[model samples]
Target: MEQAELTALLTAQGLRMVDEIGPLATTGEVAAAVSRLRGAGHSPDLVAAVVGQAHLRTRAAAKFGPFADRMLFTRAGLEQATRLEIAARHAARFRDAGLTRVADLGCGIGGDALGFAGIGLDVVAVDADETTAALAAYNLAPFGEAATVRHGLAEDVDLAGVDAVWLDPARRTAGHSETSRTRPEDWSPSLDWVFDLAARMPVGVKLGPGLDRGLIPDDVEAQWISVDGSTIELVLWSGALRRDGVRRSALVVRTGAAHEITAASDADDEPVRELGAFVHEPEGAVIRARLIGDVARELQAGMLGEGIAYLTSDAALTSPFVQSFRVREAMPLKVPTINAALRWNGIGTLEIKKRGVDVDPAQFRRKLTLKGDASATLILTRVGEGKAAQRLALLVDRV
Candidate 1:
């Protein structure tokens, strides 16, 4: 949305009209709502802005919950904003470290700023985009003096009184709706400048989970966070914010509970062993944090093969870091044999999972003719490497 439209949408009258009209789900509903609003004497620009915001707010509910109702968002800003639950955890780290004030550089729509302010930390939220800064001001209005929104370059922001810094570099091209991934070197404020600042003060840098490990600075604690089974982002904590004795960590956040596994250094890989009765798939965050070997050791499990993250053990083990599945049977990776075996087992529906293999699960599933009442999971993978490698299909059930 343009600055004028955003200004119009934030007006008291526009907000009331948006509330009265409520959320518009489908395109038909949005078009109808726009027609009705224009019929009621609202300008086309105002109607369009209100309707678009209503839809965005509904989508934002999944990320910000109740806070989304009153918040204004730009399409690209909302897409890159951190989830509220995860941002809260980030804020907790600052609060627990006794930090009283923080500078949130590159704060898009103030997602992390909201979390910091909610926990009583004064926030100076800065964004390079003017419209986004205005929206952030609107969203952070509830915090009053505790939150300050500024429109400027993150590198230009004055940090005289700030106790800590949280930086989320713009990793995508700047646009309201159309954006593409940008190379790490092209990041706004630049990683080189960010790390330079980190050396001077406590800082937390948010990056993609798949960032190259070699670029990570020594003495900084790198953490990978996963929410609801999906690995989200990697955070590098520096200076006083770095946790003692923890160099690498994986934080798993589920519906009602959260768990963390930390290590002083990367764990050694477990030895490859014969296929056991159970297979363990390490959580994505664990794998990203390079802590899959730690999980393997915890469960007394061994690697299925070199460079494979899968673990196997004779005994069924339970751990929050991994999802354990009971192995029913194994066979060579052949479609006809697997189809016949499925038919013999009365399996009608199949959940296909693959790793360390080239087979596309969707395309492979179509080749099988499913007919029966039972359902089962099929795992396709390579058990070894190079010339000695063997393709295997294992039918399993969740533990």
Candidate 2:
């Protein structure tokens, strides 16, 4: 934002425009005021931060009602906040390896740095944006000397040979939305750069969960993490992957609870279990890691059809990788027959599960005219080209 416009926003937020004061104020009070200012013109960062403030305000206003004024800005409200689950897993993994000191490259909003401090690790957090870096310092002040924030690029930062280097490259450009996908080449600390960093110290790179699995370098162990049942981000570890073989993992985080399912390594020689009566489908991370075969073997289940992402058996099995369901009924390998079976089951809430089918769920659900209080998961899949089959699945509660 321009100097005059910034001054006007500061004034609107109750900050006096001092003759000697600069356009961007570093004082905490002025910064906090800028967070609440509303106006016509705004930079993308300002707009994004303000929207984050609104989201925070909504939650604060709901809980405190009129007393929300007491609610202050948390580092999470800042633009660089990483999802809590992603940060926690990194902290846990790093700490378990006895790495007490860490450098958080691209430490936007100091979220990962905060996670490091929360786990009692020392952190040197760096960000390219001056405003974000300043705010990160402000937010990290409460850590009482545990966290350090700097403004710079990853390549320029002094590594000093720390235990691990945590890098969350800017997947999108400064003004882009979180959903906006960017190729690895577009990233600031490019994939090649990250690999270079790994050559020096163990490096962890945060990626989108939807990232193409093939693009992940063989030397980097990829991990897919989720929070509250939604997959959030993928993490890639170089230097460590070759030694650990823990290539892929699914992590679930919730208040007072945490669940992690790691990929089976070469040393984990447990034989694959036989196909069971019912099959369980694993999370995206599990499937991407090609661990489905291992899961099927673990549950003693067989693939339903050729190349399907589903397991089949007659008995119920409990596994964290995927939801377990009992087979209520089976129908002939025909669309009409499957549609008829759905109606007979009195299922109104039809959750279509297809491994290899090309039919769209929305169209199939609309065509079926599903109706009732009964909730069931239906698998509309191929038994063969001319033949099709439908199986009603019984949803099991997560353990």
**Which lDDT value does model 1 have at 230?**
85
lDDT of each: 0.90, 0.61
Worst 10 residues of 1 by lDDT: 382-391
Q: For candidate 2, what is the TM-score?
A: 0.73
Error of 2 at 191 (Å): 0.9
Best by lDDT: 1
What's the residue-level lDDT of 148 in candidate 1? 93
TM-score on alpha carbons, each prediction: 0.96, 0.73
Query: Candidate 2, which ten residues in sequence have the lowest lDDT sum?
Result: 14-23
Which segments of candidate 2 are over 4 A away from where they belong? 1-52, 56-81, 176-179, 210-217, 239-245, 252-276, 332-339, 384-399
Model 1 score (lDDT): 0.90
**Deviation in angstroms for 83 in model 2?**
2.5
